[model samples]
Target: MAFNGKYELESQENFEQLMKALGLSDEVIKKYKDLGNIVEFVQNGNSFQTSYNYGSKVITNEFTIGQESEFVLFTGHRVKAFAKLEGENKLVITMEGMMAAMELSGDKMIETLTNGEITVKKIRKKI
Candidate 1:
């Protein structure tokens, strides 16, 4: 089961909590809430790229699994993340205090993220 494909955002849950935990301002948060964010992913084997568009702002990253990879945030903050496979199709990603569990099933990809107190869920479909 190769996950080398592209995916589009379908739905999300607890977005506000995650954004708040990320230290986004009320004005920016409201803007994102009003217009919504668009997320796209391109995966090729253990390496993956994700792009998030919030109207005027965009964040993109490319990283590999089980290795320390550097990435830049939309705000220009540089950080590192280590993504590891839990089993056959589950990817566990750790960055700072944040954790994301990504489950792959055929054409569907579901990701659940948490920052200790805040949680967010995103569902996407291959496109």
Candidate 2:
């Protein structure tokens, strides 16, 4: 989704801050530190993922930041809707009320998503 220039920059900063707060590895932070172009973020249920290209290097990863984790930290937050991938797998979880839950902090939500319980697929970031 196309966003206003200001909104896009602010969102990028917000996402980057949230990632750092979650203690994402140095490698991940490095890839997104200067994100000035449009990037794609995909979501399924409570999980989310994204991919991007840094010059000639292509990077992609997926993590499940559940709604009850860090998602709630940013109230009134809405992800820009993008195209849905075909033939993607869905995750099955046994947590009670998982669907109805919302994350209280973006950092915690990111941590939960990276718990290795969810399968992540990488796609090329459209530069």
Candidate 3:
């Protein structure tokens, strides 16, 4: 899927909507926004791994394309999600209540997330 890259967060837009959709409190959202976030994506054929860093804490999840897998999210919750490739540069992940689409172009990775009507966009640059 050509989704392999290590990226640093450049900006986040409408992230409050994402937090609300995830059922997180305002305090928790504030704490999360205060941390430095970094992301890494690895693709080994059909196997995919995505890792996130927040200061001293790190969360990693792995899945296979078109296959159902159970993984841990950044909020420390266990959930079942399916990962699938959309064309050459986009990967879509769908869970129980939310969906995420990640597209890469050049040295930038753009992630768009949605839960119901709420949508958030996060942009990252290669590091």
Choose the strongest candidate by TM-score: 3
Error of 1 at 103 (Å): 1.3
- Each model's C-alpha lDDT? 0.77, 0.33, 0.85
**Clash pairs for candidate 2:** 64-113, 67-102, 67-103, 68-102, 68-103, 69-103, 70-105, 70-106, 70-109
Residue pairs in clash, model 3: none
* Stretches of model 1 off by over 4 angstroms after superposition: 34-40, 56-58
Could you tell me how far off, in angstroms, the CA of residue 121 lies in candidate 1 after the best superposition? 0.6
Q: Which residue segments of model 2 deviate by more than 4 Å?
A: 1-36, 66-127
Whichever of 2 and 3 has more TM-score, that candidate is 3
Lowest lDDT 10-residue stretch of candidate 3: 31-40
How far in Å is the alpha carbon of 42 misplaced in model 1?
3.9
Residue 99 of model 3: what lDDT?
94
Query: Roughly what TM-score does model 2 have, to 2 decimal places?
Result: 0.27
The RMSD of every model to the true structure, in order and in angstroms, is 2.5, 13.7, 1.4
